[model samples]
Target: MTSKPPLLASMFAPWPRIPIDTTDGSDFFHLDRVAGSAATGWALGPEGAYEQNLTLAEVVDGAVREALLHLLELGLIDIDSDRLNAAPGLPTHRERAVP
Candidate 1:
């Protein structure tokens, strides 16, 4: 049997050469509807939830991280559904929250 590839693990890939910035986290977790209504806004899809953009993670504020945890516990973000896909790369301001 073959092991499943590391999906989220890709973000932590080796990049020592890439400088890492050290700073405090932020508190910002903007949410939007997934393929909801065409005109009006509403949750849709497998169950019901919005798909967040990777760019939003840039503001990794302590409070935001807390909210994220809350959402995760509430099943807003599927830790198993494999949703919220994004390109492999650092987004603007993301490094600022690093370290």
Candidate 2:
């Protein structure tokens, strides 16, 4: 029998090692795909400490909207149905991209 690929194989592919810098240039963080059988999601944190998977709810939180918008503008994360449905008020990545 043929074996099927892991469910999140595509979603968890190696991401570009880009750091999202804070507006004040105080610190920066990265968004990474955490692919595992037990848990999977976007990991948002600075290097060395406080790395944690972000849930859909957390991503949509008001406190995180600014960062989320920045991420979308940078093309780090693609806008999809799930995200669109989750945060209907947010603009699409294309709409928010910098000229």
Candidate 3:
């Protein structure tokens, strides 16, 4: 048997999901698709349902980081996912593991 190359991993990547989070762990949130429309939204609930809707412009202007964080918190993305472990954001392979 032989190991496959890492570049092949990106060939079947899934589309990114929204990122968001509750400042505290007391809240639970979920994304919901809008019925009868092409748009999607999110909501929070269990005790009470509260939603913070995002505008298209807001999302395009770095607001997506919130959704990314939310997805990370939920373990929706793998620990070694390229988006989370890309270079420049991390130390070089030759660098010491600790400073």
Candidate 4:
């Protein structure tokens, strides 16, 4: 049987490394209810569901970035996806070169 491409191989890659504290909590990005803040970008607060101090401008943007980071670790994202897909798992469109 033909093997899958390396790019597509990431789909089965292991989960990204997450920093967990002794309390079994995250130590990276902090998920907070930034909706309260008037700041155009979302902000993370203490005691977040995820990490504890990662403050992002847009909550959606932050979530995506974090997810991509994890997927990249396991090679889940296809190389072509990044180059071909207008939206490479990101909020914006990342078009590849025509050639």
Assess every candidate by TM-score.
Answer: 0.26, 0.25, 0.26, 0.28
Segments in model 1 whose C-alpha atoms lie over 4 Å from true places: 1-60, 79-86, 94-99
Expressed as tens digits, the lDDT of each residue in 1-99 for candidate 4 is 134333222334432332333232432212222222212222243333244454444455665555555555545443655534533232233234222
Quickly count the clashes in candidate 3. 6
Return the candidate ranking by TM-score, descending. Answer: 4, 1, 3, 2
Which candidate number maximizes TM-score?
4
* Candidate 4 or 1, higher lDDT: 4
Sliding window of 10 residues with minimal summed lDDT for model 2:
32-41
What is the C-alpha lDDT profile of model 3 across 11-88, one tens digit per residue? 344333333342334233233111101122322322111333545564333334444555666575435567455423
Could you tell me which residue pairs clash in candidate 4? Answer: 10-75, 10-76, 11-76, 41-57, 42-57, 86-94
lDDT for each candidate structure: 0.35, 0.38, 0.36, 0.37
Q: Cα RMSDs of all predictions?
A: 15.1, 16.4, 15.4, 14.7
TM-score for predicted model 3 compared with the true structure: 0.26
